[model samples]
Target: MFPDTPVTSAALSVATRFCSPALLNHCVRSYLWGVMYGGAHGIAFDDELFCVAALLHDIGLTDAFDSHRLPFEDAGGRLAWVFAVAAGWPQERAARAHEIIVLHMRDDVPAADDPEAHLLQVATSWEVVGRHAEEFPARARADVLTRYPRLGFGAEFLGCFEDQARRKPDSAAAASVRRNVAGKIAANPLETHQG
Candidate 1:
């Protein structure tokens, strides 16, 4: 479940249609990691709200990937906007989240100014690079490297994500997910798959 925020049912419906359960769950876990990292590093965000934001951040992936687009940055933002409205998130909040999601994939986005924004970027990057890197068709990887070199914390964030994923939501399924992701990234060409 997400935080007690007002998001439109229509938006939520669209989100459900767009994202697979596995990817959605992965985003949720990534958001959880961001919350943990914030506490560990003395950074704080509206954890509940951000968790909600991160959960729906990449709802656009279905369309982007379906269309066979080489780059996901712009598409991710557009997807966020579509779901933000459908889910009933406040206009301003959704807008901000959209911008952050778009910039989240880019290395040039000024990450130093806002901690929450930075957390979103860090969390999303970690989840993708760690769990989905190799599985992520080569074109997507190439797109990421070419379009978002500055927001390039993929390796470091994956390490942090794997460490965090090992804990929380104790269950065989959770552990399996962690192990699977760790294994995928471990042998990946990206950052030596250090996690």
Candidate 2:
């Protein structure tokens, strides 16, 4: 359930312009999954911030935003920070959003302090790697997938990561791609046909 606020709309527009259809769908599904996970965990977070973070999390993977030197996650976080500042969000809120985006790739997000970051981390993990999928209700998963079909997101995203790795061998994505490309690709839930 994406909000219809101006900020949310702006983030979606930016994502749509830069991200492929499959990646954009993944972003939307990431938000839905984050919200669902937060609700299930009884965590109270800023839904709007979470929405923006989810929509823009993988933005650096887009050609327009990709930084050959910076890790894709870091590039995305920096881009989000600029976007939030440009959108008239307060400096502190923008900084928080930046932190959330940057830390989403971590194995353990510091959720004890920032529940929003934790939700985004787990939500992305669930969408990308199929982690904690069973914890959510089956109907909710089906509804989300039905609303935003994967559309071959797994292959598309893998290709994006591979390209990023090729361009920036020292970047975090490159390191990840180097470590286990096949395993990562295999773990992608979107790669499987869900009906």
Candidate 3:
């Protein structure tokens, strides 16, 4: 379960409204993965901040929030910043949400510098391409997957990134496409594991 605050609730509402079924599951699973990883690793982070960030991290990938020029993560960060401010968060805290959301797309967020961002980055990567998948307990992974399910997320996510890359060739998504991330997603061990 995630934080039950009004802000967190609003984040989930936005996700449910805009995201495809598979994308919504990916967002939720990323949060669950982050929480479980934080608990297992003793890395402390604000649950509310982390949960809201995770739920809205992929908002820019949705039709409602996608941008023609900006990277999806950057667009999504601004959207999340507005949502946080509207939910009565202080500007500083709202900025933190923006930071976490924007940083989730990066590969090198240091946990000591930004635990929530670091966790979100790793968790989302684990959910998508199975990076760091072996670090999480198999049982926890099974339960989360059972509740949310992959639901063809691999192909769906690859399509999203591919589209983003085509639209914004200078974006991080384009870089991912250049790296053949689609192949990696398809061959992910976590996606094929029977746990």
Candidate 4:
């Protein structure tokens, strides 16, 4: 279950309504991974903000929110900003949520700079390409996968990125495609491992 808060609940509602089943599962798993990673690293975070940001980081990938020219992260970050403000969050707190979503797409974020962003970036990469995946216990990994199966997320996610690349040639998605993200997605342990 997600952190209990109006913003967190709203995030879940919006994500479930906009994201595909596969994408939604990925979003949820991202949060679980971050939680486990934080616990393992003894990194404390604001649970409600972290949970809301994690669930909405990929919102721009959805048909309802995708921007034609902006990178998905920027678009998603903007939407999350609006959502946070609407949920009665202070501007500074809402900005942190926006920052977390945008920063998750980065290659790395220093924990000292922003723990939530650092944790999310690491967690998303862990889910997408198995980066630092071994740090997580098998039991917890299996539990999360059981709760939210990949549901063909690898194939679906590749398609999404491919489309994003085609539509926005100068995007992070394009960079990912150039790096052969498809290969990484295929080789991710979660894709082949049977929990």
Quote each prediction's TM-score. 0.54, 0.92, 0.97, 0.96
Model 4 lDDT tens row, 134-180 = 77777887888888999999998899899999999999888999999
Candidate 2 residue pairs in clash (backbone atoms < 3 Å): none
Over 8-45, each residue of candidate 2 has an lDDT whose tens digit, in order, gives 89999999999999999999988988888888878889
> lDDT of candidate 1 vs native?
0.52
Model 2 vs. true fold: TM? 0.92
**Residue 123 CA error for candidate 2 (Å)?**
1.2
C-alpha lDDT of all candidate models, in order:
0.52, 0.83, 0.89, 0.89
Provide the clashing-pair count of each candidate structure: 10, 0, 0, 0
lDDT at 63, model 3: 91
93-166: candidate 3 lDDT, tens digit per residue: 99998889888887678889999999998898888777886788778878888899988899899999999999
The segments of candidate 4 whose C-alpha lies over 4 angstroms from its true place after superposition are none
TM-score of 3: 0.97
Model 1, range 1-195, lDDT digits (tens) per residue? 345545433434555566665554556555655665566567756654465557666554454332233234345566666666566767787677667665565453333566666777666555554533333445544544443332333344344344334443342223434556556544445444232
Which pairs of residues have clashing backbones in candidate 4?
none
Measured on C-alpha atoms, candidate 2 has an lDDT of 0.83
